[model samples]
Target: MKILVTGSEGFIGKNLMAELRNRKYDCIYEYCRETDSTLLDDYCKEADFVFHLAGVNRPKDQSEFMDGNYGFTSELLEMLKKHENNCPVMISSSIQAELDNPYGISKKAGEDLLLNYSNETGAKTLIYRFPNVFGKWCKPNYNSAVATFCHNIAHGLPLTVNDPSVVMNLVYIDDVAEELINALNGKENRVEEFCEVPDVHTITLGEIVHLIHSFRNSREERSIPNLNDSFTKKLYSTYLSYLPEDQFSYDLKMNEDYRGSFTEFIKTPDRGQVSINISKPGITKGNHWHHTKNEKFLVVSGKGVIRFRKINTDKVIEYYVSGDKMEVVDIPTGYTHNIENLGDTDMVTVMWANELFDPEKPDTYYLEV
Candidate 1:
């Protein structure tokens, strides 16, 4: 079915789009705001379903939150009521809507607008109140509490808990995305007023921190570093060594199959080298681009595909080679690339580069194809 997704640039919106695409659903993204009404109306007119997930969840002040979350949603709902042709709407609300924060108050108002509009227009309205969502592409400082804790623990920072006793439900973003896809596919008559999207597990802040530390510690033990002597110290060293020399950064294990440890690598030098080994076929390393480093790769063994693309351009080049005919592939600095093992044998490659990996800098970009 043709579906319209609002706030398609935000974290949840991005995850939802990925999930929908995986399910083979026809979906279109639209950023809804005061200035984008015409574009939004055009999308709504053609959609069989509308996932209204736009608006800000946090603001510097209460008025900003009100304007961003409540006001924007109210206006969107009014426009939907006038322009939409009875397309079902799935509104992504927040658990904060039940709290007293300005974010919550604004979300409550947005929900009311959706329900009232649905009652008047005969449009199906489904509201999802999400708890703290974690996993994959979550930005620590801006996303949620789990991200903050994970970011700290990944980098070997002591999980600083303002209150360790406070319990929060942490749901995986994949789970939430799957639920959204399910809702989108289900019969419209089965839609409910509200759903508390349950998490696979609920954890305390302290537990979350410990989990990350444990994972990172386990990784260091298994890696070439073999830091079984003192996992904490080794992790700290590993983190410091890999961190961008000029800036502070951390790495979160977003994918389920992240084989290497979740140790946060910080760069402390303008130029350095970090390496990993892929011992099996089907292992892929990095679909990311760096703006700073001119990376070079040597095929230690086996066969693989080295795919690279220039930034902001559609020009892409793929190089396929095997162990018997090994060659060093030079990826031009400031390009996106990934190495995937295509041969039946293990592909051992060494990534030696001079660019420091920085998450905040516009260095790494992700591509699906």
Candidate 2:
């Protein structure tokens, strides 16, 4: 399918483009920063679907919001009306558009413009109202609560809750992308009306902050054996300051089998064996060369660097990895390798071997520092 996507440089647009690319669909992207109507129309002429996502998400001034969001959308609809039997236009509106904010008002106007154009030209138009979508690769300045929370938690900052009782819907970016793809693949008649993409989960701000604190505290406790009362009391005191007056029970649960940096273990399956370990920041582990044991490394938490040197050769390679990225770095046998945790937190890894782990006659050969 030939798809023309506007706002290709934006977060949602980038994700949608990647999804379409993975599905083997032909995608043409036009960034509003670099191109405008003539280029967009030419691309739309050959498209089976046109996803209109170009607009100002939020602006400090009301006039800028109207010009950038409403005006841009109106112009695009006008250009689409000129085309004969133009492809179905999927306009990405926001849940904010349903509210009274200036940003919301402009977005609502954009939606109305698309609907009016669709009515006049008899073209297919689909509208999507999205909630708080959060995930990796998010732009930091977008005022997304999820991004702010993730940033704060990752950096070990104190979480502040404006209201403990207010609950808001939160949706992961992957889920939102999945829903959009489903809509694209469905019959055109099925998406005739404006569709509201509901969040999969609803959580309160206070709950989110506490969950992060608990996860961090649990990880710290696992690494520090025989922690003194003073340190524990200090951590608890800091946590208490971020909460309400009443004692609130924590409903958040941590994954015990997470086996990340703070939780390390060795698992032996009948078919194969897997060993994992956590490295604290400024520490280096796994400097030994493996003879026949191949391993997969993932930086489960925090940022880190991996350096590998080929045996009997001057060739060397280095890679930087961070949290929740599924990038697997394969370590070939007969190579000397080491990884260093560069961030302020723990760096975790899960390693799988084809055979059982042996300490004395291990496949690893240590090299002098």
Candidate 3:
């Protein structure tokens, strides 16, 4: 189907176009400020569906809001009417339309025009009054607070919150895109008069700032955010997308010794901690037994032999491991274990502990295996 998308260069428009292309729709007519004015008439004549997303949210003068929002919408509907085309039209409106401000008033006017056109021509119209939308491609420091916070915090810039108690309703860009596609398939989630993106995240300004700050600090702390929460997962994904191109990678502090180096890769409170361990050829490490803390070790490089011995028992259990055929060895309580590099090259092992090690009360006791 041929789809015409107005304001195609914008955040929501770009996301919707990408999703449409991803779903294998190729004949899309994109109309933005840069496009030639005469092409809009041809696009309107041939369009099977129209996504009317053009609007002026932040203009130099207050009058531009009405011109860009309502005036342009009227012109587009007239062009479609002139061509005798009554295609399904979907518009991206703002939640601010319910208020009395200039921007809101302009958006409401556009909505009324679309409804009138639909009533006169019997055309299908979908209007979505979206909340604050955020995602990867959203521009920072513009209209979106989430975008600004993600960009500033990622770049080590300062953030200012005038009112911490203010609550914001947020909708992710993916959800918005999905909902638009569903509307194209005649599956819109309509309530009374307007359609909506089903998943909305309600959070305070203070809570959002706190979560973003924690995302920034996670690098230094060698920790991962709890992604089980849907809002946090989407927010974290948005935050990482704002990282400066040159600052994509950060160094992790590695504890080095004569045997090799060990670095903690990631730590989580509920899950566990993961570390990378290296040992030189013929070097042995981890000659200890844990009272309660258990671990899983997987040799990823070179060859090694893992030896385990139960306390007060002489029988030794050995597991030969190599990078060619990797295996995980579980270290249970009451058993002393050690791993020795048997290959000529250095051996690398990945270790996972059930919990973070506390120096104040170490449950480890040195014992030979």
Candidate 4:
């Protein structure tokens, strides 16, 4: 199928185009601000589907709103009519189109034209009156407050929230792209007269700021956000995409000593904590037992022997682990355990604990294995 996508370099257009190509759809005709004007006519003539996403969000003059939003839309539809190409056309309209402002009025005019064309030609048309859309590739500090906030916070810049109580309705770019592709397949989520993307998140300005701030602080805290919440998960993913290229890696606090260092990698409330442990040759670590805190230890390098002994028993169970043959040794409750580096070089072990370590109530008791 030949698909023509206007505003091909735009935030939504870029994402949708990328996904289309990723899905192996190669017959895409891209039209952007830089494309030559005469090419649009040829594109419309051959396109089996049209994604009319070209429009101005922030124009210098109010009149440009109508020209860019309504004028360009009319031109595209007219060209399609000229070719008798009544293929399905999907236009991106804004929820603000219901308002009386110039931008809204222009968007509403574009919507009316598309609906009328659909009625006249009996062509399939999908109109999405979307709210705020946020995701990767969206330009920052221009129109979207979410984009601006994510970029600023990721860069350590301060944010200015005019109204904390202001509510925002957001749709993720992935969802929008998915819904559009679904429409192309004739499975659209249609309301009475318009189409919609099923997944919409309603949040407050204050709440958004709070979540974004938490995402920035997660690096130092070595904690991961509760991704079980879909909104938080998507927002965190968006925030990470905006981080400066050089700031991708952050230093973690390493508890270093003669026996080498231990570093916490990630901590989660439900999934437990992951850490890295390094032991010097001939050094033994972890002669401790827990009442409830359990752990899994995997020797990733060098050689080691993980020894365990049941409380008040003389029986000792030993597992000889080597880097050549990786294995996970589970530390069960009521059994004292220790790992001794038996190799000539340092041994690296990846460790996981069921819960975060707390000094006030450390569930650890030291005893020889």
Arrange candidates by TM-score, descending.
4, 3, 2, 1
lDDT of each: 0.67, 0.67, 0.94, 0.95
lDDT string for model 2 (269-346, tens) is 343444455777788876778778788887677788888887787777888988768778888887788888888887
Per-residue accuracy of model 3 over 155-243 as CA lDDT, tens digit each: 99999999999999999999999999899889999998899999999999999999999999999999988889999999999999999
Mark the regions of model 2 whose C-alpha exceeds 4 Å error after superposition: 36-38, 187-192, 221-263, 266-369
Task: Report clash pairs, candidate 3.
Answer: none
Off by over 4 Å in 3: none
TM-score for each predicted model, relative to the true structure: 0.58, 0.59, 0.96, 0.98
* Cα RMSD to the true fold for all candidates: 17.1, 15.3, 1.4, 1.0
- Can you give the lDDT of residue 334 in candidate 1? 64
lDDT of 4 by residue, 272-369 (tens): 99999999999999888999999999999999899999999999999999889878889999999999999999999999999998999999999988
Highest-scoring model, TM-score: 4
Task: Give the Cα-based TM-score of candidate 3 against the true structure.
Answer: 0.96
Each prediction's number of clashing residue pairs: 9, 0, 0, 0
- Candidate 4: regions farther than 4 A off: none
Model 3 clash tally? 0
| Clash-forming residue pairs, model 2 | none
**Which residue pairs in model 4 clash with each other?**
none
